[model samples]
Structure formats: structure tokens, C-alpha cells
Target: MTVEALLIWLIVGAVAGWLAGQIVKGHGFGLAGNIVVGIVGAFLAGWLLPGLGLGLSGIVGSIIYAALGAIILLLLIGLIKRA
Candidate 1:
């Protein structure tokens, strides 16, 4: 990917992760952690959501999709930790 695209992805991931952290209390990984969660969540969403026929257009939609995926990731982590 181009440097510009990569930068955009990082910014989007950071935003989505931070938002997910706020929505899912006690699951935040702070700055670096959140960035990782968001990037991984983006990859997860890119794989899972498309299979479900969920198509999001533009940057805003991408962030929303990433946030939803990150939220799911956090929920699963919470479950695993409790189990």
C-alpha cells in the first residue's frame, strides 16, 4: 500500500479503536494498544463483513466498520478472559 493509504489506515484505526474503547468500557488498550486493536479489527472486518454482504463506502463507513469489528474483538476477549 502507498504511504498515504497506510497513514490513512492508521488514523482510521486509531479513531475506531478509541471509540470502541469508550463504548466498551474497561477494554481499552490506550493509544498503542488501541491502534493495534483497530488495525486488526479492520482486517477482521474486511474479511468478515464482506462475506455477510455488508458494504461500507468512504472513510466514515470504514471507520464504523472497523469500530464494530473492534467492539466484537473486545467482547470476545472479555469472554475468553472470564472463561
Candidate 2:
């Protein structure tokens, strides 16, 4: 990817991660972890939502998608922990 694209991705990743962190709450997976979760969350969102004709696009979209996916992931984690 181009330098600009890479930068954009990083910016998106950071924002998405922050949003995800907010939705998930507590746990607080640090900045790096947030980026990782955000990246993975982006893919997860793309996979789950788009199949239903509902994927977010662009930076803000990615952030929203990531937050939602993060919420799902956190809920799953919570359920697994309880069980």
C-alpha cells in the first residue's frame, strides 16, 4: 500500500480501536491491542454484516463497525467466562 494509505489505515485502526474499546468497556486492551482488535474487528464486521448487506465503509464507518464487532466479541467472551 502507498504511504498515505498506510497512514490512513493506521489512523483508521487507532480510531476504530478506540471506539471498540469504548463499546467493550473496561478490559482496556491498551493502544496496540486496540489496533489489533480494531483490525480484526474490521474483518469480522465485514464478514458478518456485509453478508446481510450491511457493512460500514470509510473511517467513521470502520469505527462503527469495529465498535459493534468489539461489543459482540466482548459479549461472547463474557458468556464463555461465565460458562
TM-score of each: 0.89, 0.76
| Among all candidates shown, the one with the greatest TM-score | 1
Model 2 CA deviation exceeding 4 Å by range: none
lDDT of each: 0.88, 0.72
In candidate 1 the C-alpha lDDT for residue 67 amounts to 92
**How would you encode candidate 2's per-residue C-alpha lDDT over 1-83 as one tens digit per residue?**
89998777676666777776776675557778777777777667777887788865677776788767666766677799999
| Highest lDDT scorer | 1
Error of 1 at 13 (Å): 0.7
Question: Which residue pairs in candidate 1 have backbone atoms (N, alpha carbon, C) closer than 3 angstroms, thus clashing?
Answer: none
How accurate locally is residue 64 in candidate 2, as Cα lDDT from 0 to 100? 83
lDDT of 1 at 32: 85
